[model samples]
Target: MSLYSRKAARLQLNLRKVAVKGGLAIGAAQAANAALQAAFIVILARLLSPADFGLTAMVFPIVFFVTMLQEGGLTSAVIQRETISHRELSSLFWINAAIGLALALLLCAGAPLVATFYHEPRVEGLTMASGGLVLLGALAVQHLALLNRNMHYGRMAFIDVTAAFVGFIVAIAVAAAYHSYWAIWLRGFVTIAMTFVLAWLLSGWTPGRLAPVSQIRDLIGFGGNMTAFSLCNYASRNLDNVLIGKFSGEVSLGLYDRAYRIVTLPLLLINAPLNRIITPVLSRTRDQEERYRNAFLSTLQMGLLVTVPLMSFIAGNSKGVILLLLGPDWIDAAPICAWLSVATLLQLAGNPMGWLYISQGRSRDLMLAGVANSMFICLAFVAGLPWGALGVAKAYAFCAFLSTPLLFWWATRRGPVSLRNLVGAISPFALVAGCCLVVVHLLQRSRPDTGLLFLMELLTASYATMVLTLSVTRTGRSCLAQAWSVAVSGFSMMQMRKRSSYG
Candidate 1:
């Protein structure tokens, strides 16, 4: 009675509390995962060469794009739907299983071609390893979705953290033993494989006999549009790596890839956890305009609060961070990291706009926006090819920010969340972030030879600026109070649960 059977009557009554606790649970898990990942990347960078990372980066876009499409976008559909049946879920499960196996074989077959495309012979085998990871991911997507649909994030979080820990131990051990990039690929495979095992165990789900395909036609329709968006957005975001690798070579791609991995850590931390909670929460509240609007805006502000300062510091102090994390060999990645951080800030501004679209069943809009954005970014890549890796970085950042306004208008024009709402929510943080970034950039230039102590001062001054700005404004105070209450309430709720279990 897993996917086919869930009793959600009581859960429907207090989605707010569920969302709040779920966010806290997943947030804590991701924070741990981020720390693990950051350490892994840093250590691996010192042990391996840039070309090692570059080869993996080259094939990842294709593998990741398929990963997004494997569930046929059914996971989010399952979460957002008002009702789903056992038969329908079972049908979706079998469908996912079939697609996964087919995609695995396809990736394995195409590995040689990927190797051919980049003129890098080593990637052929790496792509095949990624195929195994794909198969594991497809098998578990439905089970994980079942858990997500019911907002069982506490259990899911525990499973996720455990998988990440296992991946960390295994990857590092392999890297230490083999001194190869296979360790990086193994990290992906092990994490997905472990998550699949634990998800089935903890998801309390056992798929029943398959139902007729007709029963899930509407779900397929919903998911198909999402799949289209995934395809376009994948091209938009990942094509840069492909372009750089193919034209500028592995060393260039590797440096850019390392810089990118380091700079985008905060975005992943904020986006991944909130995404798990907010999509389902917003989906449930979509019928209530006020509740829906408040939930989306509150989530947007909170994310910006974490991301802006972090991105600003990284963009402004890329040199110090590079030296500290990756050593002198990767010092060349500093400017590339800075530009990528700017692009990330722009990309992140529209991240939650996706929650708005999915909750409102606007996948078609999402797809169109993705296509248009992809077209522009692709042009930017082509235009920058003559200038090598740094040129590509600069061009990508400028084009992404240029395209963001249109994306905002397109995403919010018809929804309950309007353009004005989004602009207002982001403007204050943007202002504060810009000021702090400028201040830090000037200071860093003036003290070019300073060490970690200087980084501390910059961090302190950045947060101080944010706090002062927020403290002075009514809206900022409201947001801070709301954030504080959520934190306190989530902690209290956990303690109560522990006490009840002990009794």
Candidate 2:
């Protein structure tokens, strides 16, 4: 082969190696995090009351809003940029820090307003206490961004696992001592604080003098549009919590929050890594049409294969799942969990498309689509407010099912990927899920549908059915082939100690 072709092949191999290893590291870390949190919540639920969780849920929307501002979406700019200088990094760091401090102060000041809105005096302290979160989140963004840009996902995964461990320890201790909601809030604060410190230490980049704003105006513009999208998306996702805490009261909100977590935990595992890896890889391959399209579609297929059936099982057996995870004390949360799992299954279809826009430098499209999607979701939340948390979950699921098609079309149009390609990709996963749901429906007719044994029986049957079906499907075999290739490649550089410092 010619030297040029040889070089291209090697570069492609390296990228695949990095992407595969990064996915594994992140997947492993999130799995560990899920295990730790599952254990923590199991114990915490026994120690704390639903009202306690409700109090903190009231402050989360505001916290999430500032959390969006603190990053300013510059992390994406850093990763998506073909090149960046230390001066640019320094400027972004300072910008992030400034945003963090300003947001921290703002949140502290507005804590009272959050309490007032909820008519719950307990939320005031929780909101104010979360003031530091904005700062902590902001400070870490640039550091983590550089790591991602450099393909340091293994290190990032390590940091994530370590931070989660620390948070778990701190939360357990606090709960043992006080048995209050503060334990839950402090868990997050401590985790972010740890991540900020660890991120800086491991990231190896330090701020120098800031560059002139003119030097980064384009980046700022790109980031600002991304930030707009995030804000809208966050509002749509969290508004239910805000509304529930406001109208349905603390106990109800707490139940819904737990149910939300139950469904989202698996998503976090699949999504956290994919979202981190997509832009950096896709950005580099934008000019390579086939490569870009395959990366996005393959990622979607593998992610859905792992995630959807699991969520379907949860949705079908939410009562049993809840009983196993949170115990009978949260039995009433079952409907919310089931509906939320349904919503998640539908929404997962569109999740990967966010990065498609980012990699293509189409933040304008992202922001516009986010606005429309959020409107539908927000309206659903409002409509369900009268019926309470379960009502909200059902509404959200219905809306997601309706809006998902729009997202796919909007994201794929005018890009390397097309609506036809999307439908081809999604069709397989949908078929498998549809089959699983059908089997689950048939099984629901059986007697003795309660207790641990019944739950296990149903879970086993659902998964076994899914596995048997997927084994026969062409897409499933392809996904399996992808996994096999990644495994057999076994790049030596995947081991962090053996490789050069990615930073």
Cα lDDT tens digits, model 1, 1-503, are: 56422334344447868887888889999899899988998899977899989888998898888898787989978988889888888888888888999999999999899888888899999888788888899889889999998889999899889999999999899889989988888888899999999988998777888777787887898899889888888887788899899988889999999998987798779988888889988887687677688889988888888888888888889999899888899989999999988999887787777898888888788888878888998899888878888888899899988998998999988868888988878877877778778888888888885487888898777777787778777778887888788789888988999999999
What clash pairs does model 2 have?
A: none
10 residues in a row with least lDDT, candidate 1: 4-13
- lDDT tens digits, residue span 1-503, model 2: 99977886787777887888888788789899989888887888889989988888888878888898899989988889999999989999999999999988988898888778877888888878887777888889999999999989988998999999999999999999988788998889999999999999999988899788888998999999999999899989899998898889999999999999889887788887888887799998898888889899888877887887788888877887888888889999999999998899987887888889999999999999999999999999999889999999999999999999999889888888999988987786777777777777677666537677876777777767767776786877777688567666554545554566654
Off by over 4 Å in 1: 1-13, 495-503
For model 2, the stretches where C-alpha displacement exceeds 4 angstroms are 1-3, 444-457, 490-503
For model 1 the local lDDT of residue 292 reads 82
Candidate 2: worst 10 consecutive residues by lDDT? Answer: 489-498
What lDDT does model 2 reach? 0.86
Residue 58, model 1: lDDT of: 92
Residue 207 of model 1, lDDT score? 82
Model 1 clash pairs? 4-86
For candidate 1, what is the TM-score? 0.95
